[model samples]
Target: MNVHITLAHPEPTSFNGSLTYRAETYFKRAGNNVTKTDLYASDFDPVERGAHYKDRSNKDVFIPLGEQRAAWKNGTTPEDVRSEIDNLRNADLVILQFPLWWHGPPAILKGWFDRTFPSGGVYTSRMRYDEGYFKGKRAMLSVTTGAPEEAFGPGARGGDPATMLWPLHYSLHYLGFEVLHPFLAHGVQGHGYSYEDHGKAECRLAQKLDSWEDRLAGVWNEAAQSFPGWPDWDHRGQPLS
Candidate 1:
């Protein structure tokens, strides 16, 4: 199987970095061809603007959706966008690795979605949801948080993980990727602010890394997390009751 892992953290020596390294080694050992995209190391620009559209449909106006559609149709899409899309096309599984910041993924990853998934080429109004472009592929998020696991719950201190991750997960669903349940690493702090002793915290973090490896061993056979599809909605996009 072919796999692609996209890492969005800035620090190469960080825990997020280690997890990516671990995945690269593990996937290769499992006989899967793996491709990696380190956003910071590669200097991926997170901004979407007129500058990216070299051969614009309308020179005076900068409508992102319009420009993307036109560029794709004209074979003038940005080089970076084209390359990322190519990587995605060749992969059977995609792993998005990052440290949760401001309750979501980094800006670069967000921009990756905005740019790489071209409007006219990859998705259309009637071609989305269950019938999306990358239908048979699978995707998952591996995220780290600085707060302890116990601090997270409904109305808890660290906020609800499910709710926080909904948008990112839904976006994958939009692309027709069967999204696996996310792998979360909690209480991951660069400093000693995670409310745990040094030795215990290190041990716990190590355990989490090991568990991640174990989890991925059978992830391909695991069921994709269910989400509402076109069959569940009506013409007005309301839930069928």
Candidate 2:
């Protein structure tokens, strides 16, 4: 399978980076072609500018200002962002690897979505509220969190990690990607914890990669099950059942 892994953490030696490296290694070892997009290393621009839309044919093309404004407030769009979008368009699976910063993805990764997922980019405005681009793709999040898993449970340091992930889940699902259970590594900041520990965490991560490899190689049955019909709403907010 052709896979693309996008890493957003800045530190090369950080736990997030370590997981990305391991994931890439495992994917390749499984005989899959893997492409890596390190956001920070690539210096991806995160802000959107007027130029992106300045060339619109009509001054009143009915661009969704609310959505465009939201993206701009986050960051500027990178010049080479289209290449990343194209990668997603062609990939069999996409893995987003990042650190849990303030209970969300790092800004760079979020910016990636802002630019790559707008109308006329990946999904069109008419299809935004229905099934859209990326209709048959598969995606997963590989995250490293500094806090313990308990801290993210109900009524703890925050709420459930799954709750915090709703937007991400809905976004990918709306774009027609089959969502996989995330691979999360919690307690990275615990006492004596290190990315190179070569201990239980590493072993567990390896096991997770093995499972992920198997899943990626499997036929995309979930996509058909979730979207039994085309252009209709499924439980995941897209068309299927």
Candidate 3:
């Protein structure tokens, strides 16, 4: 199967990078084709602005969605966004690898969501949720945190992973991919930021990498996270059950 991995971390040698590398190796070793997009390395611009569109629907104002719709309709989408969308289209599985900064994904990755998923192209009023363009594909997040796993969850210092990741997961679900449970690596600090002995930190992180590999082996068979689809929502977009 074709697999696409998008890495959003800046440091190539960081643990976040390791998770991405490990995933690529795992998929490739299994004889699957792997495609990687290192957002930083490629210098992906995450900001949405009128600069990207030359023939604007309204030059006097910068309406992000309006320009996106026009671009999709006119085949004038920025080359980078078009390329990324094509990569997504050709993949069976997509892995989003990033570090949790300020309780969210990096700005670049967020921008990728903004630009790549074009209006009228990937989704329309009638093509969202269960009917999204990537309906048959799968997507998952490989996220790392500097705090210990114990520090997360309800009433925890680090905040609940579910709450932190809901927006991203929902966005993927919006695009029609089956969203898998995230592979979370907690206590993932650099040598300088580590609270424990450097050796102990290294040992723990290494183990997390092992766990990630094991998880990936069963990723395809793992059940997807539950989200409200079209059938589960009413005309007013309220949950039916």
Compare the candidates by lDDT and give the number of the best one. 3
- What ranges in model 3 sit over 4 Å off? 191-193
lDDT of 3 by residue, 44-143 (tens): 9999999999899999989999999999999999999999998999999999999899999999999999889988999999898889899989999999
Error of 1 at 148 (Å): 0.2
Instruction: Point out the higher-scoring one by lDDT: 1 or 2.
Output: 1
Model 1 over residues 71-173: C-alpha lDDT tens digits?
9999999998888888899999999999889998889889888778889899999878799999999999999998889988789988898999999899999
Return the candidate ranking by lDDT, descending: 3, 1, 2
Q: What is the C-alpha RMSD of each candidate to the true structure, in Å?
A: 1.4, 6.0, 1.2
- Per-model TM-score, in order, reads 0.97, 0.73, 0.97
Q: How many backbone clashes does candidate 3 have?
A: 0
* Residues 95-192 of candidate 2: C-alpha lDDT, one tens digit per residue: 89987778788889888877666654556544543366776678888777776676688778756788777677667777877777777777664332
The CA lDDT of each predicted structure is 0.89, 0.68, 0.91
